[model samples]
Target: MRRREFVALTLPSVLVMFGFMLVPLYRTVEWSFERVSYGQAGTFVGLQNYLAALTEPRFGRAVVFTVGLTLVVTVVTICLGYLIATLVNGLGRMRPLVLGILLVSYVIPHVVGAVSFSWLFDSNFGGVANFLLGRLTGGDVLWFTDLWPNRLIIALNVIWSMLPFVMLMILAGLQGVSRETLEAAQIDGAGTLGRHWHVIIPSIRGVLGFAVLISTMDVLRTFDNLIPLAPQAVGLGNESIMLYIYNVAFREGAEDLGLGSAISVLTILIILVLLYPSIRSILKEAKEA
Candidate 1:
């Protein structure tokens, strides 16, 4: 392609990215170093917001909660997704129907799915899950208001929503596995577990790594689901990083824009750190290819 044609083809997307992403990112970074508010000029306050965010107890808890949730959700979803994908891949005629069923949660909007998911546990809504569990255990479980129970529900909701996408990715990877290699492994007396551990998983490492990266990033920015699912997040110490930022910057009576911006910057750094290994492996693979 000619340079002129290449530039013309890419110019529109480049401009859009600059206008939508870079502009907001620049403003956020600028605001992080100042005492800021909406629609008003900010006073310069270098490093003060950063220092305050670092020192805040709530911020510390939010970090711990968000990071822990990300780790747990990423691991669980990858394992479960791989297993489900393996089973689904073996199906002949029912694969489409099964996939459609699994994808219902993923296609629903996060807030709507969360509201529906919450009703399954909220006794006020005649929660079937809570009622069944109560009957089984002979006790009522508080899914909300309590710290651990609330966390469990939130994690479950996240896993439920994200599992489909991970499964689809792994299923796509499974399609590319070498049948000849599997046959050879079987001939070598490799059992089902041994074949998967030695042959299939290694073949799809890239797909699994990509799934983990995307899932980690999504879980780290968890906010919409929590809105309907974790109303008492602040009180229960279940506040995610994004929720904490929302409370500080945009919530009524807490317009600490600078602090929120600082936290956002810190969060981007944390995500980059968490994703470094996966990103490096991708780059290395691309270079080799």
Candidate 2:
């Protein structure tokens, strides 16, 4: 295609992205250096906003929770997703139905998922958690209110929302695995575990790495679901960095856009640091391939 034709095809999207995304991102970074309140911009604050965001005790706790959530969700989602994907991949004809059912949670809106799960697990209500725990332990398990249980609920919510995407990615990778290699491994006296450990997992490490990186990032920035799950205590015990940013940026009466923007910038840097290893592994594998 000619340059004009190419530009004609992509110009609208480019302009839209520039207007909606790049403009706001540029503004956010620029505003991060200012002491802004409401609609008024105060004097240039240098890195004071960033300093405040980093040093804030609540922000510190949120960072810890975000990291912990990311780690736990990453591991759980990868393990469960890979296992489910393997099972789905081996199915002869029911794969579509099974995969579709597995992805039902993903298809639902984040808010709906959050609300549904929250209500079902509400400690006061006669929901699933109360009923099951009532029967099992003859007592209610506090799905919310309690620190550890609330954190566990949030972690489970992230995993439930993320598992389908991870599974699909791994499933696609599994599709590319060499049947000949698996058969050869089996012929060489490798058991089911041995064949998978020696061949399948290695072959799909790139996909696994990518899946893990995506899931980790998603869990780190989880916000919408968290809102419905724990709206009152967003920047508290179990909230992520993004939640804390939201709380600061749009806190009830007065918004602190400057500090929020600074925190957001710091968040991007932290995520980059956290994901460095997985990203490096993926890039190295791509280079080798």
Best by TM-score: 1
Which TM-score value belongs to model 2?
Answer: 0.90
For model 2, how many clashes? Answer: 0
Estimate, for each residue in 118-161, the C-alpha lDDT of model 1 and write its tens digit: 99999999999999999999998889988899999999999999
Candidate 1, residue 244: Cα displacement in angstroms equals 0.5
Whole-model Cα lDDT of every candidate shown, in order: 0.96, 0.85
Candidate 2 has an lDDT of 0.85
Kindly list the per-residue Cα lDDT of model 2 for residues 1-289, writing each as its tens digit. 7999999999999999999999988888888999887677567989999889878888888888888888899999999998999899889889779988999999999879988889878755558777877889887666666777778788888888999999999999999999999999999999999988999999999899889888877888888888877754653477778888877888787588899999888877877897888678889999999
State the TM-score for model 1.
0.96
- In candidate 1, which residue pairs get closer than 3 Å at backbone N, Cα or C atoms, i.e. clash? none
Candidate 1 segments exceeding 4 Å error: 275-289
